[model samples]
Each structure stands twice: as structure tokens, then as C-alpha cells.
Target chain A: MDEFSFIDSIKQKYYKQPTLLKGVGDDAAVFRQQNKDIVTSVDTMVENVHFAKYTMSPFHAGYRALAANISDLAAMGAVPAFYLVSIVIPADLSNEDAGSIFSGMESLASLYRMDLIGGDTVSGKELSISITVIGYTEPGRARYRSSARQGDLVFVTGSLGDSQAGFHILANKGEYEEESYFIERHRMPSPRVDFAAKLSGIKRVSLNDISDGLANEVNEIADASQVTIILNEKDLPVSPQYPQFPVDLQHKWKLYGGEDFELVGTVAEDDWESVKEAASNTDTVVTPIGYVAERSLSSKVYLITDNGKIPLYSEGYTHLK
Target chain B: MDEFSFIDSIKQKYYKQPTLLKGVGDDAAVFRQQNKDIVTSVDTMVENVHFAKYTMSPFHAGYRALAANISDLAAMGAVPAFYLVSIVIPADLSNEDAGSIFSGMESLASLYRMDLIGGDTVSGKELSISITVIGYTEPGRARYRSSARQGDLVFVTGSLGDSQAGFHILANKGEYEEESYFIERHRMPSPRVDFAAKLSGIKRVSLNDISDGLANEVNEIADASQVTIILNEKDLPVSPQYPQFPVDLQHKWKLYGGEDFELVGTVAEDDWESVKEAASNTDTVVTPIGYVAERSLSSKVYLITDNGKIPLYSEGYTHLK
Candidate 1:
């Protein structure tokens, strides 16, 4: 099928949003959202830089690309509403592979009731997918990384380091009974939109998604909020099978390895109970790993361990200089 | 400069939207657009497919990418507001080149008061840019391709094939007195957002942007509106230097050459004067080219010439099978 036919098939099969004034097959998509603030984010994943053809299936690539963007929306305390995808297909890729990519995105989108409003498909030297997601939050209530305050409890949702472990296993072709769990975590991370929505009741919260590793994310919150953060290393949450990996690898992955798609944020000490209640309501695990304090000179992040306090530098996967 | 520093520089320089609650340096950007319909469009340009290093400058590539997306919003009769850019940077690209790309977009963005809200930067095999633009229109006032009426007058804004001729000149490295005009046109085709905003006064207008050539765009409108459209060949608009090229090349480019970034639409005969006045107010040139008719069987588009009536096929640059 040609480009038009493929788009038509997608529209017929998946473009069903009654609230959208127009969706697909137009110069632009139109919709109306009254009385809510709009949150928008875009993420792009390249072939080898993000995922390899041998290591990742097309469906997972698609799912991961959308998941990364959706995680951003969740970090901002917003509800996923609509998304537009732009894919660059290499010559070697099959039509079925392309379709699988969309199917992968659709699988995640359906769970959030997000509409596939618009997108562009083109030929390129290698496969690349860029997704722009639009979400909604209450007026003046969207969370930011610059809102952390002294005495606030720094928390993280779900287990950390699982995705990195999963990726390591896939890259090395490791054989283990727990491989599927790691692979699934890496491939299909659940965006914490539900848990984030529950935290909206908090008067003020600071959030940053753990996409570029805990070190990088926490540093960002500290820098943005102009506060120092101290995390208890022993309090870091890990999956059940995390202990199977070497101790050094576990430490590295949990602290510096990224792509966990978990939420790392700070809430007031008084609101900690509300946060815990919200997490319990959503069946999400919440762990208080750190606390925010006044910055003496500049913002800094540190980890407290049995040895001593060590500086937590931003050592995540930075793309370019 | 590292990734964070580069983003920090961008945030300091270009992200200055007073209305945005949040901008760069966050997981997502937040803004509230009360009591308005949202319009969004995305466009992607690959290294070799859409442009080349030898033929286009970094600034022009960046400018053109955003221009294409803005044109889409214009066709929907919306006012351009905010945009997110996702760029895949090859290793060979210099920091200056990347900065130039954003500078190019900022130049156009400043003209329309558009905010550089959010985006992603990634390392890839080849240079690619994907831009998503968000605009706003009065509730229920956005135009659609499916709204053309049988008695509507088909019209086009400005010249059609200048961009194609300009691209030909650039690719061939030809030297001529009019070379700069064509080159400039090819590099920075103006999107008709102002004209589109003016056209909003007219009710029930059907519109499409000429990014896929006149024939393909008109065919799309015909197909979407389920009406027959007949274009008068003698009435097709061309630039002053258009006649310098061979007649066949002019004919082919005018019909099949895309990327003019002009608006093509149909307005009711009663609203024709209103359209003309709107164009005049915006200092835009408007020309009547054809008329919409009842579809006998399937919707079709045809060109009326001295030779006879010829069917217009959707022969634009379609990617993939």
C-alpha cells in the first residue's frame, strides 16, 4: 500500500475521538479543551542510538517512544489526551513492521484514552520515531521541577534500575528465568499518569521523571529548585530479581543507568500521608528515598552510605555537547 | 557544552513566552489557552529526501521545517502560537550549525509571536528535523477540506511553482539574474497565516495547503469534499520569471511540484468578495482558479486547457509503498 492508503487504514481503524473536531486526513487536527492548562512534550528515538533492530522489536520501539513522551506528561501532573507521531522508515523495513509500530503505540494510547490525532510518515536512511504528546492539567496546578522546598520529602514511585538491567540482558543475550520481567520493564514501561493524577490534591509538589537516571533527574530537581538533596542509598528501591546482578552493576544501574520511566519528586512533610494514600489507591509503590534542604552555596545532590556522603553527579546518557 | 548546558542556553535566549506557565528545562511545557479551539500539525524533513547539505544552508533547513508546519495550521484557519522541535543530529554537524537551525526557527517564530515551548535532541546517523506546531482558532471556526460546496469558487494565494523552479536552480547550481529570488523563495517560502486569519470571516470555506503540489492538494480537497473540481489552465498563477523556463517544465512544476507553502481553498460565490477583501487587508495576492461541481460518481479534479480537459492525478511525492 502507498502512503495515503496506510494513513487511511490507520484512520479507519484507530482515529476515533468523538471530542476532536477533526482528526487525521487534514492539514491539522482540531480539538477543544476548556478550562484546563495544556502540557506538551516531544521525544525522538533513533535506530542504534535508542534501540537496535536485533535487540528490540518494532512494536517495542514504538511503545517505548510513546512511553517516554507520556512519562513526561505524567511528570508534569497531567492527563494524556492526544498525540501526533512522525516516523522515518528505512527502505529495508516492511509494511507490517511499520504497522506493528503504530499498533504498539495504539496499545498504550488506548489505556489512557489518548487519541491519535495526526502524524507524518517519510522515508529515511534509518528508522526514527518522534512523538508529540498533549495532555491537560488543572489551571495553575501543573507540577514543575522548580517547586521543591526545604523539609520536603523526596520520593520515587515503583522499582528503579529494572529497565537498565533488562537492556543489559538483551544486549548481552543473557539467559535467565527473570529475563522476561526485565525485558518487559524496559520495553513497556507504564507511565505514572494515574499516580500523578492522584497527587494533584497536594498543595505544591515538584516532579521530574527518571528518564536520564536518578542521579541526573535528582540533580535537575535540585538545580531547578535551588536546593540541596540528600538520598539514603540503602533506601533506594529495587526489583525482586535486582540482587541477582553483581553488586557493583546493581549500584551503577540503580544510580546512573536510565530509562526506568519512574517518577522522582518532592512533597511537603505534612502531605506525605496523602501521597502514600494516593499511591496505595493506585496500587503503586512509593518510597521516600531522600529529603530537600536549603542550598548553602549552589544546588547539589549527595548520597549517604555506610562509607560516607558522596556527591551524586549528573552522569546519565547525555546526547550531545 | 553538554546537553543540559545547551538546553539552558536555549532557555535563556529564546524561551520567553509571557503566557507560558512553564517552558524549557522541564519534562513538559505548560500553558493555558482559554475559550479557544486548538489546532495542531507535525512535519518531518529528512537529510537527503527533503533537502541536502550542498543545496540548503542549516539556517534555511531550520526555517523551512517550521514554515511547513505553520502552513498546515494556516490552512486550518488558525493563529500560530507555540511549537516543539525534535532534531536528530549527525555527528558531523557542528554546534554552530545546530544553533543556526534554532536561530532560523526563532526568526520566523518572533514574527508571529510563537513560543519555543519544548523539544528533544538526539544523536543519529543522519540529520533529521520534526516540528509540531500548535495554533488556536475561534470555537467551530477552523476550516476543513471536506467543507467545499458545489458552487464555491476555487482560489489560490500567490504563485505556485516558484519554489520548484528555485529548487531546480539550486540543485543544478545555475547562475542567473533572478537566481537570488528563486533561491530565497525555495529557502524561505512564506506561510499564509495572516491571510488565513483574515479568511475566517467567511463561513464554510474549505482549505488545504499546497505542500504537495497544486494537483495533489486540489485532488485532496475534491476527494474530501466529494465534489468535482475543474481548474482553468490559463488562470494558474506563476511568478514573473516563470515564462523564462520551458513551457513543459513550467506546466509540470506548477501542477506536480510541491512545497510552495501557499494556501488553496474554495469559498462560496457569495463570500468571494469577502475573501478578496481579506487578502487585500493582509497585502496577499489572491486569484480565482476554478469552481467546485457536483460529483457524478467518484470525486475528481480536472484541468481545462487549450488541448482539452485532463484528469489531475495525485502524483505528489508519496513516500513508501
Candidate 2:
């Protein structure tokens, strides 16, 4: 199908939201959000750079791209409402694969009842998907990276390093018994929207989605909040199958390998119980792996390991160096 | 500089808006829009496909990309407010060139007092920009392509095909005395946002931006509105230097050449005067190009020329065929 027909098909397939006045077949999509602050994030994933066509299916790529953007909204303590996807299609891509990409995104968006408002489709040399998601939060209630306080507990949702391990298995075509579990983690990451939405009731929490691994993300919180973060290495959450990997690779993946799509944040000592209650309500696992400390000279993140207290540098997936 | 440093530089350079609760350095940008309906459009310009580095400067490409998206909002009769830019940078691109792309977008954005809210920057094999612009209009007041009525007069803002002619001059390295004017039109096409913002006062209108040439835009309006559009070829506005070009080339450019970034729509004959007044108020040029007729069998667009009336086909740019 041509671009217009494909768009028409998408318009026909996706259900509309009550607030969406206009969806497809318009110069712009129009939506109303009453008395709520809008949270928006844009993310682009390119072929080869983000995913290989052989290793990552179009469906997974689409799911992961949209999931990553939604994770951003979740980090801001917002509920995703709408999204626009701009996709650059390579000539070699099949129509089924192209449709699968949208199917993947729709599968995730459906869980949140998010509408696909509008986007652009173009033919290019490589397949790339740039998604812009719009979500809503109460006025002045959205969480921020700069809100972390000294003595606050730094916590994480779900297991860290599972996605990276999954990716490693997929890339190497590993035939381990746990290969399916790892691969699924890599292919279908669950954005912590439910857990984050519950955090809106807790005041003054700092949050950041772990797109760039734990070391990089906590360091960002520390840098933004002008505080020092101390993480207990043993407390880092890992899956049951994580021990199957080499010890060194496990350490590396847990620390540096990115694309976890889990929330890492800090909450007050008094509010820790509330956070745990929120996690329980959402049926999500929450782990306190670290604690915020007063900055000595400058903001820094440190890992408390058996070796020693070593500064955690942002060695994860630095783009455009 | 690395991606983080580059983003830091951008965050430092761009000014913030009062409505913007949060800008860069977060997972998502948060902004408040009180009671206004949000109008959003996303457009992606791929290098070597939409533009060539040799023919289009980075600054112009950036400016044009944002301008195109803003034009969509304008077509919906919304006031341009904020934008997010996602840029894919090739390894070969210089930092200065990379910065120029944003500079281009900022130049036009400053005119509308639009804020550079948030976006993504990634390294890729080709330089591409995907921009999502968010604008606001009064609730249920945004214009649509399907709003045209029978006996309405079709109107367009500014001259048509100038950008195409300018692009031709630039691509062919033609150094005519008017080359600079045409080149400027091609590189920095004005998005008629001022005139469109004034259009909100009009009661009912069908609007479409002439990005994919007038023929395609009018046909879109016709198809959406279920009306037949009859255009008078003689009434189609042209630049002062337009006649100097070959007649056939001018006709081809005016009809099929895209990237004009002008507004085209149909308004009631009674409302035509109000549109003209709105144009005059904004100091914009407006022309009566055609009239909307009742759809007999199916929606159609026709042109009245010296020879006879001819059916207009959507021969504009069609991506991902």
C-alpha cells in the first residue's frame, strides 16, 4: 500500500479517544486536556544503531520504541494519553513487517488507552522510528530528577540488566534454557507507567527511567539534585536466571548495559512505606538499592561493593561522542 | 562535544517559557496549557530524500523542517506555541553545522514566540530532522480540510510555486538575477502562520497547507469535504519574477512542485470578505483561486485553463510507495 492508504488503514484500525477532536486526515491532531499539565517526550530509534532487522523484529522494534517514550512519561509521573510516530521505511522492508511495527506499538498503547494521534511516514535508506508521546499530570505535581533529597532512599522497579542480558542472548543467538525469557525481556519491555502513576500521591519524589543503565541514571539524579547517591551493589535487583551468566558479564550488564525501561528514583525515608504500598497496588516489584547522601564537593554516585567504594561513572551507551 | 554536552549547550542557549514547567535534562518536558485545545503535527525531513546537503544548508533544512510543521498548525488555525526537534546526525557533520540546524529553526520560532521545548539527538548514518509542533486553538474552533461547503470560494495565501522555482535554481546552480529571491523562497519558505492565526475569527473554513503542491492540497480538501473544486488558472497568484520563467516550467512547478508552505482553503462567499480583511490585518496576500462545487459522483478538483477545464490529479510527492 502507498503512504496515504497505509495511513487510512491506520486511522481505520485505531480507536479514538474522547478528548481527541481530530486524529488522522488532518493538518494537525487536536485534543483537549482539562486542568492538567502536558508531559511530552520524543525518542528516535534507528536501524543498526538501535536494533538489527535480523535480531529485532519490526513488531519488537515498534513496541520498544513506543515503550521507551512512554517510560519517559512514566518517569515524569504522568499517564500517557497520545502519541505520534514518524517512521522512515527502507525499500527492502515488507508490508507485513511495516504493519507489524504499528501492531507492536498498538499492543502497548492499548494497555494505557493511548491514542495514535498523528505522524509522518517517509521512505529513506534506513528504517527509523521517532515517537512523540503526550501524557498528563496534575499541575506542579510531575516528578523531576532535581527533586531528590539527602537521606532519601533510592529505589528501582522490576529487575535491572534483564533487557541487556536478553539482548546479549539474542545477538549471540545463545541457546540457553533461559534464552526465551531473556529475549522476551529485550523484545517486550514493560514501561513502569502503572507504578509511576501511583507515585503522584507521594510528594517530592525524584524519578528517572533507566534507559541508560543504573550507573548513568543514578548519576544523573545526583547531578541534577546536587546530592551524592550511595548504592549497595548486593541490593541491585536481578532475575532468577541472572546467575546463569558469567559473573563479570553480569556485573557489566547490571551496571553499564542500558535499555532496562525501569524506573529508578528517590523517595523520603518517611515516604518509603507509601512507595512500597504504591508498588503493591500496581502489582510491581520495588527495591531500595541505594540511599541519597549529602554532596561532599560535587554531585557523585558511588557503589558500595566488596572491592571498595568506587565512583560510578556514566559509562553506559553514550551517543554521538 | 558528546550528545549530553551538545544537549546541555542547547538547553543553556534556548530561553524557557512560563507555561513550560520543565524543559531539558528530564525524561520528558512538562508544560501547562490552560483550557486551550492542543493542535499537534509531526513532520520528518530525510537527507537525500527531502533535501540534499549540497543544495540545502543545515540551517535552512532545520528552518524549513520546523516551518513545514508550523504550517500544519497554521492550517488548523492554531497559534504556534512550542516545538520538539529530533535530529539524527551523521558522524561527518561538524558541530557548527549541527548547531546551525537548530539556529535555523530558532530564527523562525522566535518570530512566533514559540519555545523549543524538548527533543532527541542521536547519531546516525544520515542527517534527518523530525519536528513535532504543539499549538493551541480555542476549543472546537480548529479548522479542518472537511469543513468546506458548496458555493464557497477557494483561496490561497501568497504566491505558489516560488519555492519550487527557487529549488530548481539552487539544484541547477542557475545564477539568474532573481536567483537569490527564488533561492530564499526555496530555502526559507514562509509558513503563513500570521495569516492563519487571523483565520480563527472566520466562522467556517476548510484549510490545507500547500506543502505537496496546490493540486494535491486542493484535491485533499475536495476529497475530505466531498466537494468539487474548480480553480481558475488565471487567478492563481505568481511572483513578479514568475513570468520570466518558461510557461511550461511555471505551470509544472505551480501545479506539481511541492514545499510551497502556503495555506489553501475554501470559505463561504460571504466569509470571503472577512478572510480578506484577516489577510489585510496580517499584511498577507490572499487570492481567490477557485470555488467549491457540489460533488456529483465523487470528489474532484478541476482547473480552468486557456484551452479548457481539466481534472487535477494528486501528482505531488508520495513517499513509501
Candidate 3:
């Protein structure tokens, strides 16, 4: 198809927001904001590393790309406003597939009242997508990893290993895609933008979405805050059936298999009650599994097992094991 | 190299600005802005279609990618403040080469006083770079293509066809890369941000950067404003030596060849004197080559040549005998 028709197919299903002065067909998109600092995040998902046709459909890949950036906005306690979808696809990609990709993204954009502002589409050696999400948060209200303090309680929303567990199911073909509980979790991580929006009312919180596994994300907070985090293995919110796998493999996926979009964060011990109340109002299940303390000389993160306490490796948290 | 060290290498060479609340090593880059509307543009440059290693180095590719987005900001009359660099590369790219790419982008970012805020680095089949530029324009004062009026004078900055002329030299044999003017023209079309900055002080202007071609850009302005544009063939600022090529090919490059980052815009006929004064004060050359008129039954864009008056075709504009 021609470029104009291709662009029309994508723009035909857009959700135009009132805040947008202009969307596509302009030199640059224009938007107005007040009383909020803009929160921006960009991420790229490539064909084999992030997704494959065998693992997920083109529509899911498109949704996942936008979801990844939205996950970051959730971590920042920002409300979705607009996004730019920049995609590079193989020359031979069918027009139908291209339209599907945009349709999938439009479905999610519609959900959050976000406008698809401006970006470029170009042909590349393989399918690769980069989405830049533009959001805004109240001044002095957005969460940050560096704000966690001593005596804070570390809480994580939802399950930790659903995405990775779903990934394993898709990678291996024992179960059908639709029948398995893991496929949707792996393919469509409904980013917690609403849950994050609720947290802006509460104060003294620091959070991050678990995209690079719970262990890596927890360590990032610990390192940024210069505090020590002790996570109780028994308290980790895992899928009910995941622990049935070989303990080592189960622990591997739960701690380090990445791609989960759950928000893990810390709240001051005194404000925990209010944070929980806000989460309850949003119907978001936030589970506290650890506590922050002063950092010692050795490690910033520790994982307690049935045997004893062991230091967690900062890099991937797996090298020690 | 590991992702950590690769990110660290790039982050180490950055020039931080006070407006940036946070940079690399966060969930998302944070910033503060007031009074101005946020201006955003995202563009992707693929490996072979946009650049080949034979014609441009990886460093040049990285620079050109950011330059493409910066050109959009220029057209919007926005002062570029931050940009997200999302890059996908083959797994085999060496650390030194990767560092070179970031250095090239950093050079441009430093010159513009723009912060390299947030993005992702992923593995892909071939090199692809997507840059999202975040800028701010004076509230209600940005130049738009829809604002051109009948009887307005259309102007272009510097010269056209240099980039395409430069492209032919790099694509074919004979001339080496260094000694010629066209190579740099092709490799680095310095975006007209300064010129646009000057125009921001002027009122009621419409502008766009020539990415696809001058004819395509002028047609966009005419179509958007619902007016007619007429070009004087003698007034077009072609490179002095470029017109020496065969007349047909010369016209082809001048009128149709893409990738020229020059600014094309229309201003009220009365503002011409003040606009030229602003351009000269900034050491920028503003050349008036056409005028906007009420649309008639003929083409929205026309070129007056030796043969006769002819409508400019929106697609490539190459239909003269």
C-alpha cells in the first residue's frame, strides 16, 4: 500500500484527546499542560529478543511495546496523556499486519484516553518498535527510586513471575495459548497507570515497575536510596501454581526472568496504612514482602531462604547462585 | 559489552542541565517546565534505507537520527530541551563503535544545550535509531503550516539540492569523501533551529523543514493553508556549482531530491523586511522564492519556468518537458 493510505489506516482509529492541539500531519505535536511536570519514557522492543511471531501475534507485539513505556509511567506515578509510536518493519511485511499493529496500539491508547501524537514509520531489516510515552505528574508528587528511606516497607503490586511463567509456557508448547493462564499475562501486561494515579494522593513513596525482574528492580531502589532491602522468599507474591515447578527453576523465574509490569515500591512505615487504603480504593492488591534498613558494607539486597540469609548479586542477582 | 557498562559509557559524557530533575539511572527521566507548551517529534532512521556504512559512519547515523528530530523542532520554533535516544543494534557491534555513536549524538546535544534524558538499548537485526525530541515553544506563538495566508511571501533558508548533490557523490564513484562540499552537506544538514528561533519573534508565520523535498514541503504549506503557492525558478537558491550538472538531473535534485534540512515558510508580505532583518542579525540567509495566493482551478503549487507556467505535482514534482 502507499504511505498515505498506510498512515490513514493508522490514523483512522485514533482517539483524539481535548488537550492535543495537533496530532499527526504537523511538524511536531503540540500539547498544553498546567501544574504538572511532564514525565517521559521511551523503550524499544525488537523481534527476537522481545517477541516473535511464534510466541505472540503482531497485534500483541504492538500492544506490548506501548505497555512497556506505560509501565514506566506507572512507576513514576504519571497520568497518561500522549505517546509517539516509531516503528521500523521489514520491507515485505503485509499491509494487513501493519494495520493490525496500529489497531492493537490504538485499542490501548483508547483505554487510557491517550492521543497518538507524532512519530515516523520506516522500513528496516526486521520488525522493531520504539514508543515514547508522554505523561504529567503533579510537582513534588511523582515517585522516585531515590526517595526510599530507612524503616520503609517495600510493597509490590500483583504477582511477580506471571509474565516470565507465561513466557515459558509460550516458549515451550505443552499447553495451548488460549487455555494457559500465563499467555495473556505474558502478552498483555495492563500497565498499572490507574493504580499509580491513586498513589499521587499519598506521600513519601518510591516505586519502580518490575520490567527487569523483581530482584534487579529491588536492588535498583536499594542502591539508589543507599539502603538495604531484605526480601522474604515466603512472602513474595507468586502465582499459586508456579512454586510447584522444580524449586531452583521456580526461584529463577520468580526472581530474575524479567518482563513483569507490576509496580514494586516502598512506603514510609507510618504512611503504610494510608497507602494501603488508597490501593484498596483503586482495587489494586499491593503486597508488602520486605523492609528497608541502613546499608552495611557487604550487600544492598539479601534474599532469605529456608536455610539462611544470602547476599543478592546486584547484576541480575543470579551470578552468586 | 554488558548493558550496564554500555549505558554507563554513554551517560558518562553527558552535559546535564538544571531543568532536568533527573537523568539516566531512573525509572523515567524527569523535568520541569512552565508557561510554554511542550513540543514533541519522534523519527526513526533505519540502516540501509536511511544510511549505509559506505555512505555514512555509525557516528554519522546517530548524529543524523537526532538531527532529523531537531529539524522538526526548528520548524515548530521550539527550543529543544531534551531528547530520548532509543537505539537497536546487532549483537556484534563493538564497544568502541557503540561509544562512537553516543559521542556523535552527544556532540549535537551539547551544541543545542539539550539533555539526553531517557530511552532503551535493545538488540535487533540491524541498526535502527529513534529519537524523540521534547521542546517548548512560546505559548500560542509556534509557527504552523496552517497559518499561511493569501498574498504571503514564501521564503527558504540557505540553499537547496546540496544534500542530494552530496548524496550522488557519496553513492557513486570518482570523488573521495573528504575534499568535496557535497559530502558534508549530505552527511550533516545542520538543522535551521537558529533561523526558526529568530522567526519565533516574528508573528503569523508558517514553516516546515524540507525532509522529503522542497516541492513536497511547499505543497504541504499550500494545502494546509488552503491557498496557492507559485515559485519563481530563477529565485531558487541552488548551489552555485550544482546547476552546472545536466539541466534535467539538476532540476531533479533541486526540486525532488529528499533529505535537505532547509526551512521553507510563508510570512505576510509586510513582515518580509523585519523577517529579513532578524535573519541577517542571526547570520542566517533568508531567500524569498515564491508567494502564496488564493487557490484557483489550477494547481495549489506552481513553478514558473522558461517553457511556461505549470502546476507542480505533489508527488516528486517532476512532470515538466
Name the top lDDT candidate.
1
Better of 2 and 3 by TM-score: 2
Interface RMSD of each: 0.6, 0.8, 0.8
Ranked candidates, highest lDDT first: 1, 2, 3
A1-321 per-residue lDDT for model 1 (tens digits): 777778876663555555588888899999988888999999998988888877679999899889999999999999999999999999899999999999889899999989999999888888999999999988877999999999999999999999988888887865665999999999999999999989888889999899989999999999888999999999999988899988999998899878899999999999999999999999999999989988544999999999999999988575212
Better of 2 and 3 by lDDT: 2
Where model 2 places Cα greater than 4 Å from the true spot, the runs are: A12-14, A173-177, A295-297, A318-321, B12-16, B173-177, B295-297, B318-321
Error of 2 at B31 (Å): 0.5
TM-score of chain B of 2: 0.96
lDDT of 1 by residue, B95-211 (tens): 899899888898888889898888888888889999999999988889999988898899999998998898888767655659889888889989999999988777789999999
**DockQ for the candidates, in order:** 0.91, 0.85, 0.84
Worst 10 residues of 1 chain B by lDDT: B10-19
Off by over 4 Å in 3: A12-16, A175-179, A296-299, A315-321, B12-16, B175-179, B296-299, B316-321
Candidate 1 — what's its lDDT?
0.89
Candidate 2: which docking quality band? high
- Model 1 residue runs over 4 Å out of place are A12-18, A173-177, A318-321, B12-18, B173-177, B295-297, B318-321
Better candidate by DockQ, 1 or 2: 1
Q: How well is each residue in B50-81 modelled by candidate 2, as lDDT tens digits?
A: 88877788899888889899989999999898
Best by DockQ: 1
